[model samples]
Structures are given as structure tokens and as C-alpha cells.
Target: MATSSDRHRIRFTVHYDGRSFHGWQVQPDQRTAQGELERVLAKLTNGPCAVIGSGRTDRGVHATGQVAAADVPLRWSPHALRRAMNALLPDDVWVADAEMAPPFFHPRYDATSRSYIYRLGLASEADSPFRAPWCWPLLRPVDLLAMERAAERIVGDHSFKAFAKAGQEERGDRCTVTEARWAPWEGIGLEFHVSANRFLHHMVRYLVGTLVDIGLGQREPEEMDRLLAGEEGLETSPPAPAEGLFLTAVTYPADAGTKPPRRRGPQLVP
Candidate 1:
């Protein structure tokens, strides 16, 4: 339970299937996760409600633990508001949980780290209709050792300019990658898990594409070193298919939903 305050901030988690929506952000004449949420919330709040998400996932990128925040009228408790919104939202999106957040909670600003997992399937059955929507079906084995070696370089702070899409350098292309690793999935090819303070547009997909190519022996593993050098002359492979990407979690300051002036620990690690 949250005590009364000058402002009422609501924090919520959502899990959405991105196939039917344009992306996380609202766009003109587009179906988006944020748009759907704001619309339903506005109806419930009986006013214009703005829902701010932790990140802007690309089109067709799913999220199992997307975090967001909003300000609603003081009359509504967190549980009631969550139920109301869930009742009105479409089937593709589900409000996993909601809570009364502290007045100062801002979804994006208060987040300390975000984690994403990219799934790939190597078996011929990976291309099955049932599996294609969730994972990349390569249908052929890739060199896991090579990919792991390349991923090791991703740890630590560095300029990810090469892995991100262009036109974003205006915001400066840098991210602190605390963890980047590859692991075998349940009878699937592998899943790439990368946790970072922040990610640039298409950075994860591009890194996956390049790493896959390295596994295929199309590129050298040291290319990651050159790309992070922040100099020209190296380019990453095409971005991986968006369907394989899932935003697994967003790590916020522990005190994010408690009150104003959120307290944060060091970025997530280990």
C-alpha cells in the first residue's frame, strides 16, 4: 500500500506480442503498445493520460517485462487501476502487474539497466510454422565458439557506433554493456543475453547479425574490437530479424516506485 501524496504515479508491467503492433512508441495512424495503453488509461482516468515506457522496442520486437509509468487520479488504487486497464486492453497485450509508484518515478530516467534475449533455432524444425514467430530459424548450425569469443569483447563501456543504426549519433552512440554472453537453449540453437545500462537503436540485432556471421566464419572475431574503436572502416552485418528479440526485463532503481528522488544502485551485473 502507498501513502497519500501530492501526485499519484502508477507503475505497471506489460507483456505484449509485437506482431500486431507497429512498435512500442506511438505513431500517427499506427497501432502501438503505448497508444493502446494510453487510450485505455485515458478512458479509465477520464482524462488525457500519458504512459511512458522504459524503452522503444522496434517493430515486431516482443517484451515479456516492459515497464512503464503514468499519473492517474488519486481516487484509484494501483490494483483497481490495473484491473480496469486490463479489462479494456486488447488480447495481444496484457498488464502483468501494477502498483502505486512514488511521485517522482519516471520509467526511462529511473531505469538502471535493461536486458534482452535473442533466440535462434538451428534445427530444420526451427522453421516450423509454430516456432518461426518466436525465434530465428537458421536451420543450420553456427560456430558457437566463435560467437562466444566475439561476445566476450562486448563487456565493459565502449562506443557501439558500429552495431547501431545510423541517424542516432545525434544522441551519441555509447552504451555500458555489463554482460554479453551466449548459451544453449532448450533444444534450440542458442540465446544471446546482453544486459546493459542502455542500448542504441538496433544495437542488439546488429550485434547478433555480426556475431552470427562470425560463427559462420564470414567475419573475424576481432572485428568487434575494431568496431568499438570508434573509427571508420568496419561495418556490422544486417540487423537480425526482429521476431527473435524479446525484452526480458528492465532494472530500475530499487526505490523507483517508492517515492520521489529515486535511489539507485550501480547498474546490474553478475
Candidate 2:
């Protein structure tokens, strides 16, 4: 049991635009989600605080359900912590919700799966300044059927070495893709949705770029198989732009931690 002054865990979900910020992780003199959150938390806790994140989202990648955990004073209720933290955070970043977690809880290692979505703007209207921040506007139409077929091939356990960036192979490139699909986006374009046990660096963006290439007839759909098989020396298309990607959710087993804390606004469900 925690004493009155003892430190326990607090888990929170943060939403960020990622357009102006450097990324999720902290870097010296760089504006980042984690950096800002840690700053405010340190002030609130009245000392140094290390905020651990579910993972590092690349620069320009947005997230609606990015999970992070930190130890704070035992008296800081999840609701009060969120309200206080949001008061000091900039408009681009906000704590959507928070929960009290076990001392052993770790956002990244405890996650059962992580989900991401890539939005493609197929319609010409996407060029509007208002719509440019969250989507990739394609100037030319591509075959949606081909993209769907390629997405189907991605639903399984695979090495994915070819899809990841160089040096990511040190941890091994295997990922178990439990769910993967392409769906229409409100009659405007298509979006790729995928959930995996783990992801290698830049794997999803690479997959999206490769699938888009196949849709444009730049490569055969069968190339997905070769990539999964870790075929050496076959290069992939350039990664999809970071703005098109969003971390939609993260899942954890019920036993992984404690019940979610109460909140005042619409909760960010994971």
C-alpha cells in the first residue's frame, strides 16, 4: 500500500495535432508532446518527473489516443491531475483522460495491441487549406480494389524486415498483425486500419506507401508477399507522409492494470 507521501502511477491519454511539435519524445530545445507534458508534470509534482510513453510517434504524426504513464503524488486524483495539467499545457496538446494505474504498469510493455490509421485524400477538395493538416491528398486516383487486396495480405504474423527502416532489425522485425483492412472514408477516399502486437519503426508508413504503389500500378500486388518473406535487396516505395498517419488506439488486457479514473469530458476510449 502507498503511504500518504508515497508515489504511485498515473496513466493518461494525450491528443496532439503534431503539425508544429517535433514529435512524441523529448529533445533538447525541441517542442514535443512528451517534453511539454513532462514540464507541466514536473511543476505540478514540484520535482523532476519522467513521463514514459507507449511509444515514440515520428515527427508530424498525430495521435488521439497516445498513452503515457508517470509516478505522481498519491493524493493527485486522476481527474484533478488531468484538469491541472491541461491548464498549463499549450493548445496543441491536451490530456484527454487519465486513470490511476498500478505501480508496475508500463504503457508500452503492458499494451496488448496498438492500432493506427492512415488517411488518404482522394477527392480534389482535399487541397483546401483546412483539410491539408490531417490527410495525404493524392493528385491522382488509384485503384481501391488493389489496395484492399494488398491490405488483406498484411493480416498475419510476418518478419516485415523489408518494411522497416534500417537498423530496426536489431530487435527483430517480426510483428503479429491481428487486424488489417482498408475502408472507405466518408465517400471522400480510403483509409488503412491496422492493429498489431508490435510495430517496427516506420513499418506502417512503408506498408501504406507500398500498397499505394500497387494501387497505382507501380508495383504488383504480389510484392507484399515478397516483402513479408524478407526478400533481400528489393526496395520499397518511399514511406507515406507522416501527416496521414494517426495513432487511433492502444489495447491492454483487463488484468494489466487498474480501473480507469473518472473524467469530466468525453473520454478517449482505447
Write down the lDDT of every candidate, Cα atoms only: 0.86, 0.85
Global lDDT for candidate 2?
0.85
Model 2 spans > 4 angstroms off: 1-5, 257-270
Number of clashing pairs per prediction, in order = 0, 0
Q: At residue 208, give the lDDT of candidate 1.
A: 94
* Candidate 2 weakest lDDT stretch, 10 residues: 261-270
What's the distance in Å from true for residue 82, model 2?
A: 0.7
Residue 110: error of model 1 in Å? 0.8
Q: Candidate 2 on 61-173: residue-level lDDT in tens?
A: 99999999888888799999999999999999989999888756668767889999998889876766877688899857998888888888999888888888898857887
Worst 10 residues of 1 by lDDT: 261-270
Clashing pairs in 2: none
User: Candidate 1's error at 15, in angstroms?
Assistant: 0.6
